[model samples]
Target: MIYIQLFFSFLKIGLFSVGGGYAAIPLIQSEIVNGHGWLSMQEFTNLITISSMTPGPVAINSATFVGLRIAGLPGAVTATLGSIFPAVILVSLLSLIYRKYKGTTAIDTVLGCLRPAVVALITAAGLSLSQTALWGELPVSLSSVDWTNALLFLGAFFILRKWKWNPILVMCLCGAGGLISFLTGKFF
Candidate 1:
């Protein structure tokens, strides 16, 4: 039953999420955190972080992790297969007719419209995580924001802008900083 839920939830996300991996974040978060209660808000944020850092697309990685969390290895397989099903079917079918509409202005216009919607979805996911990190649990006062995190975020943003360093290096540094902070009682 849990496996079925995981498969169908991800399958719905795959079917309806119009854009690529990042675009699925909002829906995946909603399913994992809000809809099914499969993951906590913090877990969802961690999932996003881990997914972004891993090799494959964010959506696939997340589906696999969430599925594993829910029902172990079998759930992981089920969720991954479910998530890719829509894309596989649609792309295969569309490939045959793609040439006919490839030159159409309508196709272009639809995609142009879709771009912003995808951005909005990604933005919403970030906002949800921001709320979780900045404020305590939901339905609570926002009196105690983590000042240490605020400072680190600002510092990282400016450094990234100025240095234009590789993202993997930045992530590594952040991870190290987080570990140090945790050790020092600034975090945790």
Candidate 2:
């Protein structure tokens, strides 16, 4: 029963997560954290962090992690297969049609329309995570704000947009900073 549930939950996630893995964050959060009560918001956030930092698509990684956490190795395999199944079928069909209709106005227009929606989904995911990062958990109070994190967020954003630093390097630098801060008791 748990394996079946994991498969379908991830199947839904895979089916509707049109834009990319980033766009799937909210859906993943909604399913596992809100719907199933399998993981808390903080755990979801950490899952997201681990998923994004590691290789492979975030959704796939998330499925594996969530499944493993919930059930075990069999669950991990089930969830992963479910997650990729839709993409595999859809991409195959879409590729065929795209090749056939490569230059048509309908195709171009549809693609153009989808671009904004994908951007919106990605933005929403980022904002949701940003709230957790800057302001602590939900039902957020101003007093819960982490000023250091806010500063780090702004600094990272500035560096990325202004100087175009390699994102990996910035992330590594931030991780080091976080570690040092932790050792020095800045987080407490």
Who wins the TM-score comparison?
A: 2
| Per-model TM-score on C-alpha atoms | 0.90, 0.96
**RMSD versus native structure for model 1:** 2.0
Candidate 1 residue spans exceeding 4 A from truth: 139-142
Clashes per prediction? 0, 0
Candidate 2, which segments miss by more than 4 Å at Cα?
none
Residue-wise lDDT of candidate 1 within 65-177, one digit each (tens)? 99998899999999998899998999898787777789788988887898899889878876776676666476646467766566566667788999888888888887888
**C-alpha lDDT (0 to 100) for residue 74 of candidate 2:** 96
lDDT, each prediction: 0.83, 0.92
**Which RMSD values do the candidates have, in order?**
2.0, 1.3
TM-score, candidate number 1: 0.90
Q: What digit string (tens of lDDT, one per residue) describes model 2 on residues 1-188?
A: 99999999999999999899999998998999889999988788889988998999999999999999999999999999989999999999999999999999999999999999999999999999999888868778878887767877888899999999998898888888777877887754
Backbone clashes in model 2, listed as residue pairs:
none
Q: Give the top-scoring candidate (lDDT).
A: 2
lDDT of 2 at 2: 97
